[model samples]
Target: MPPALNRTRLAWAGDLPTSRAACGMGFVSTPELGHEAVAFGVNALARLAHRGGLDADGKSGDGAGLLIQVPHRLLGGQYAVAALFEWDPRARAIVEAAVTDGGMRLADWREVPLDHDSLGARARETMPGIWHGLIEDPGVDPDEWERRLYLVRRRAEKQADQEGVRMYLPSLSSRTLVYKGLMAGTRLADFYLDLRDQACESRLAVFHQRYSTNTMPDWRLAQPFRMLAHNGEINTITGNRAWMRAREAELEPELRGAVWPEGSDSASLDNALELLVQRGWEVSEALMSLVPDAWEGRGDLAGPVRDFFRYQSIRFEPWDGPAALAFSDGVVVGAALDRNGLRPLRWQRTRQGLVAAASEAGVVTMEPADVVERGRLGPGQMLLVDTRDGSVLRDAEAKERAASRHDYALLADRVLVPVERHHVDLEPLEDLPAHHALHGWGFEDVKFVVDVMAETSAEPVYSMGDDIPIAALGRTPRRIYGYLRQRFAQVTNPAIDPLREKAVMSLRVLLGARHGTLEPEGGTDRELLRRHHPAVPTEYKLLELESPILGAAELARVLEDAVVLDATYLPDESLRDALHRLCREADEVSGVIALSDRRSGPFRLPIPMALAVGAVHSHLLATGRRMAADVVAIAGDAVDVHDVACLITIGASAVHPYLAFATVGDEAAPRYRKAVEAGLLKVMAKMGISCVSSYRGGEVLEALGLGAEVMEMCFSAVPSRIGGVNLDDIERMA
Candidate 1:
């Protein structure tokens, strides 16, 4: 059989750490094209060189790059440029052929002049031959020409990958070009000789000096990406990437496999934004959709703006994390901050109509007298400068412009249907002793965990640290959740105080099919109308739940039409075989797949809820059916906050802790559910995550005792170092 889809090479390396970094990034824009914008960007990079990593030699840096409007003065505007990393003659030939097949003529090829002496020893060894392929446009409108160029680039990339050619196109557009490499920030302009040439001028320039964190430094990993330069890490990138992969079938043909697997979290975000822009979304609209503000609890926002965020939440989860972004599409330049405002992005405007924004102030040196205004972007704020009209838009004006494009309040009202709450008769356990034994509920669990929540409607607090031995080293049997430990933010990424930041935190979960294409095919007016004003299809429906913790009645109502799968193993079945069987069964079902261990008896063993959920979730992802169904775990062993969080982190949509409810009895069940919900939120806050949607499938845990094989089969995306037990050992322990 083929390897599991979620299996990554990083797992075999014994680590699956998430990317985290605070890098130097900025942009400079002018009302008119000139050499000053390019020169200012290079100067900014030099000033921020301290924020980037440097090799032992001091000459080699993490990465640095400059993204600027196409230098019409140097290359002319009649032809579109493809800035490529093509070292091989064969690869260049293949790219030229792709351009020809894509219905474009290769007008000329210009070898990008470079000063090799300026590059460090390491960079020189890894650098590819840089060149610009100028393709003649086929007498079409500007929009059509851009679309055609995108198609050609995608086609060329696919062909190059298939041919095993080491080629990369950093930018391919008539409007913009990129000059970047793996070198010290101060040497960027010196290495790329074109940046120093006066003829290489632009109206806007987005620059970046990367500080390597999760991945090693490479030429292609340098920013700014085709559209943006990012300063902070994407904390929920694992889930974000997985969700995007699940939606591959729904993507436009040209963007089918656009996200590169080897790219950093910043690159992934850029890829998503580029796809949205190519599909007709305004740049600000797409940015707002991806990294929305804390609008759910804010009474200060306009009604339509609140509705806009709510409507967007249904289609996409916020890319929750610390982020400070600077973006431009040659004409309009802008900057934005994530909801948390974890990174600094300061801006200043000169009296000469020069607007500059960077990770730090003073990046673009201007005399104090020339500074017209200076400010920093607050949390969930944006600043845009449109060179065409010389219009400057701050947060409110920019967001309002995008929000007013459609009647979002009406759209949300028509599409988002809240899940109905029903009061069902609670059925008490007939035999207390039998239930306790069957579900592994002990005296400590009832007294310390469940009873406290039942009485106070709050998670139980303990003063001392955990004294019990970790699962792998303990002699007693342990659940799968015990093998994994929750990872919290530290150092560079600050953990949020859940109580203080309650306004930004959310537990809302939307259940049902997501709309496929943002832009419809054929490009007809009717198609465009449907794209902008979307409503749930007649045959489909969406159910929104305020929290993932389900009460007895809520669980029953949700499972009424859900596909129930048995998560119990027969006496002869191995744990691995049972998990595989459960995955196979769940893959065949649509809508909700409820994996329940309610069938566990003296003759059958209950599969650990986390294990079952992780297995089935990864299986569905591998088969590209993950988006088609939601996994709601009706678990017997999931009795605490950590247990529920583990299930969710491994891809469970919602969790019903049946055993906890049964132990607490009917009257206290609601309190128990609320307590669990509160605890779940605290867990998310500890990791600096704001929403449960982004936390789902986030893989924010570290397995201390699980063997590599076990991790690969189940928690494939989670970090598993100091490996110990395998499947057989796990089965024996169980």
Candidate 2:
């Protein structure tokens, strides 16, 4: 008989302790056949729970560490621990014996002292709001309050507590959790919190304290319902913050009493849109407008699909990154990623329909299929595994997986249908009074028709600014980051359906739009109409024919004719020239356009280009990072992004990557990483550096900040763990 799989739950090295989060963040699937599936599920949980790597953004004064759930093999020992740390490699090994076994006494917890002396003493003497209880109780001893100076004492204690929190910091460190009294190991890396429940023991600050990907966690501000985890860098968070801030600056004429507190951008944005939906609009309507899709109009889609596309066309794009989001109202729980589909989100199904996502799949071992599924979403897609719904549902209507191999053999023969621009012929429109057209149309008529139409609206078109879909980003920097952040939640690291389809779809979409030929195969064909790599004309003459059309429709047509095929391939000297032309336009057309790549290597065939790509690829391999961030950061207005692919092969160092499709290809590119890492190490070796030895040898613990991670990695005999609710455990209990 085949080996039976245990119920899916999170697991790690025996030493790592499990952190009891207040809510759920990544994908949560129901456990099916045990072993293979269970292994994957737990890995996802572990990865999601694992702390993130340091922020290379140079923002953190001290480099960051991700103690979440890394494998434990790094700590060499008999029956080795499972935790490991990807650290700065500059710190000293932690003094293992320094950790005491008294279970961190109350004296060690260091509750902040609230002093009522000085300012408070004087203020309470004059003002009523200064001291609520003490003032109410006039007989209370003012001497005690005056000596302690309540607020001051609290601040001091808070500072002291901060040090303790930092000491248990994220790293290659591990912790042990008493889960059902089992010695399951978990590293600091796999310690993500699920904020869907009422605040739990370690989750009192979910709403106020955002986790420090690099910065510090402010428990005082965090509250229940806010999610905190790690993935790639998010450049768009700033933009979203800007948009939310600008929107709040104005009263909107409708909301007169609204006053959003500063630094509450993320929370406010969530609240504002939620309010809109609760007030009337559907979920799609509210989200789409906030996170619009790339504009490539499709005339063939049914109402819902068209509506979804249209919804994308109108809203302001959200910033991009590979983000693994955690959200809740202290009730509903969920997570989502950017549309580029970089990063990975995973989950295990349980009795209750909840989903968890993270950067690694093994974090949750019970459910580990990497292929795409309903609970597993593609780019530009949202997985809605609501605890309330008891089933996983796709929120935005995503294109179903294609049925047949792309007909690339006849790629040049498809047709294009662009949406006609919104312009009325003056002569004909003049004859009809615009105001009079509304003649007897009552508000009820519009509402009634819309409601009825909504139910029967063949396609799934949501309203604008309704839900902040991860589809809002436009550039490579944004795309890479968006995918990382979004899919990190998919820790089981499922495949992105669309990325696999990019090449096939690219040829098909281009052939149809550029050639102006129509060939409908199935329901999803309409999706091509919405956005295909722009239609390309074989020659200048064909380009002229489609030149008259404007807006996304016309643009889509032109894209087929002119869009860059291998966006990341180009010669060094010619690189600047090609990028200049690509970023420019033929008069009215903007250089901003769709790009496609096979994640291939024209660069490998070319020496200079190959060298560049080798460097970049090498860096990604050694560091387990991505190339888009560096490339996008360096790309100017007229820059050619193709060179970025070269960087992947050439430069070596760690960076968070956000790649998908063929772009999303495999778990990662190994050879490229080897080249990048070897090259980087060679350079570092020149400085006489190696891991923990050599003339350049440094202290391992303090220098590298690997204490927590070390504990985890060493935890097989002493595994760290996060003790919290997992979907399977909850299911079994239920």
Candidate 3:
């Protein structure tokens, strides 16, 4: 028979952990110290218990977990102790089978002795199944064997899961051990017996007390996710997940196809980082690659630093959003923040070599004279401690080492190709035609829209709030982007102020297909520090498209040096097919335009601009040819700021609403451009993104009624919780 089921029930009827910012705290002392630090860690959790969420029952917490260095005596057998209680014969057989299957030999299974009779009702009710297993390994290299042991644990857990057995791995590494549960932070120590034992000690302990936005709590979804604890959200997680899927061809079958735990964005990030580390990347380098600072347009940073980020950006888009994280690999402990400093992380150092960090100050108390330093983690900064070397590296020192590891500037200059642009000097737009009747719309309605723009040029404001049904449910056909709405920071995390914090924000973007050869399928490259080689030459023109609101003359001038695929005359070819062919055929396909020349009731482009761009971008990525060109939307249907922002959000680098230019005339183009820019800024500012590039291809949207299949194709991983219109509806609408 299968192993007995022992999973925590999914029952949550209370406030979520994400309703407010989470409180994550860590305590680490030098020299592998014991109990004193472990006690401090538990005390820290108890002090911050109020930050955790409470359910309707006011007994269960949102979730809490603690990670600490593995006790050497436990694995070294110096203090070996026999089993206090005999393991069941059936359980032993299952554990042995799992261990053998994972390429490890099992020595013995021991049940952790617990006095359930003495436990409080709440602790007894909320506890999960627990056990301690020993592996047969001769005294050998610890790091190598421990890594293998970790993988073995993972594989064994996967096997157990398939047999309907729920294995709760609080900790599986020789270097680290985890103790966690679905209990209030204040009760974590009481529920996990190890925490209560004074003899159990460690030099480092990281704790996380979660408060998710939605109150539906699952015990398995708790923080301190195996490797790290993250606060704040990953807004670009949809696109980030898509990129990970695209790289599946280069991963092992189990890793490529394994089911991810249903946690928050932080869980996904930890999974990715684990994979990268298993592929030979240093933890610090992996963190930098995943969440780099604003470097593209900054001249203040060293050339090597800028080059490092520029090269990494092509391979991985920034996990852009507000975030603060504390991570550890048993020997190395660290913390980092996102580029936008929307989350708080404060740290204090004691003279006796203890460093404590948390979301709030005073979580760990120390005497005034004992305090060596007190500071907070800034945007894109990191703090790392290496217990092996007994050294601590702050942001600058850590980044400097990462940057200087390779000649990124030389690599970038040799293989990085930028967009090409032609300089056009032109007078302000003037003497335009009265094309108000072009689409058969009344001139007065057109005038009213244009007049409102003229009046609101200084500060565009909207009086009519959006309350209509989404396109999937509406009677009138709408653009594809209309089906998805931009999701912004809510109660859990704070949003950035574009005007107040422009220094850290960037608008620069890089467009074109990647140039490097594909990494080998189902394999990892062990050369983590080698210079990157591009399959194609990296040197190309850097084309910066500010906005799509372009005049005909300006558009013509820019196209002189570009290979333009005119949407106006695709002949018998589908736009998607044409764009794909262009990407494959051209040596340097820099730009694409979706043009609408029809001036009748079918005023919209045959293909909705958003759908066209999204389809093209998704196809290019699928075919391993996304860096070929930038998509431009020269649409007639886009006039208001909403239309333009929608097009850009979907995938277009820039959008030219030429119809608006024609209707408003040349003299009004500048005013119209200002109004549109202001409006787009307001829209983006709502989500706290400062620049267009960060927002570009973010897939930071939620679909109210879009079907799953279409969303998977054009906007995969986008949150479309409420399924609605299918492909049939989309085709009919189009």
lDDT, candidates in the order shown: 0.82, 0.26, 0.61
User: What's the TM-score of every candidate structure?
Assistant: 0.92, 0.31, 0.78
Off by over 4 Å in 1: 1-21, 252-254, 367-370, 420-425, 517-538, 572-574, 722-724
* Candidate 1 C-alpha lDDT tens digits along 422-530: 5565666567667566656667878898899988889888999899899888877777888889988765667888889898889988766655535422123565467
Ranked by TM-score, top first: 1, 3, 2
C-alpha lDDT of candidate 1 relative to the true structure: 0.82
What's the candidate order when arranged by decreasing lDDT?
1, 3, 2
**Best by the TM-score measure:** 1
lDDT score at residue 196, model 2, on the 0-100 scale: 15
* Predicted candidate 3 versus true structure: per-residue lDDT over 1-734, tens digit per residue: 11121223223323444434565555455455666566666766766666777655555777777878765554454211111111223434555575676566666665664545433455446555456677665355666665565566556556655766654554556666766666656656665666666577677888887776644555666767667888777766656665665565554555553225354677778777766655556778778888888775456777777877876765666777778888887778888888777788888777677787888888776777988888999878888877776577888888877777666666555544444343333333232333333222344435656666855573344588757686766776665656778777776655677666666665455444443212311113334323343233334543434444555654664455455543432335444453345334432453433333332222322445555566666765576345555666666556577777776667776776766765655566677777887677766777766556657766667787777766765665467888887655654554
Q: Score residue 567 of candidate 3 by CA lDDT.
A: 42
Clash statistics: count for each candidate: 0, 236, 24
> For candidate 2, which ten residues in a row score worst on lDDT?
692-701
C-alpha-based local distance difference test score of model 3: 0.61
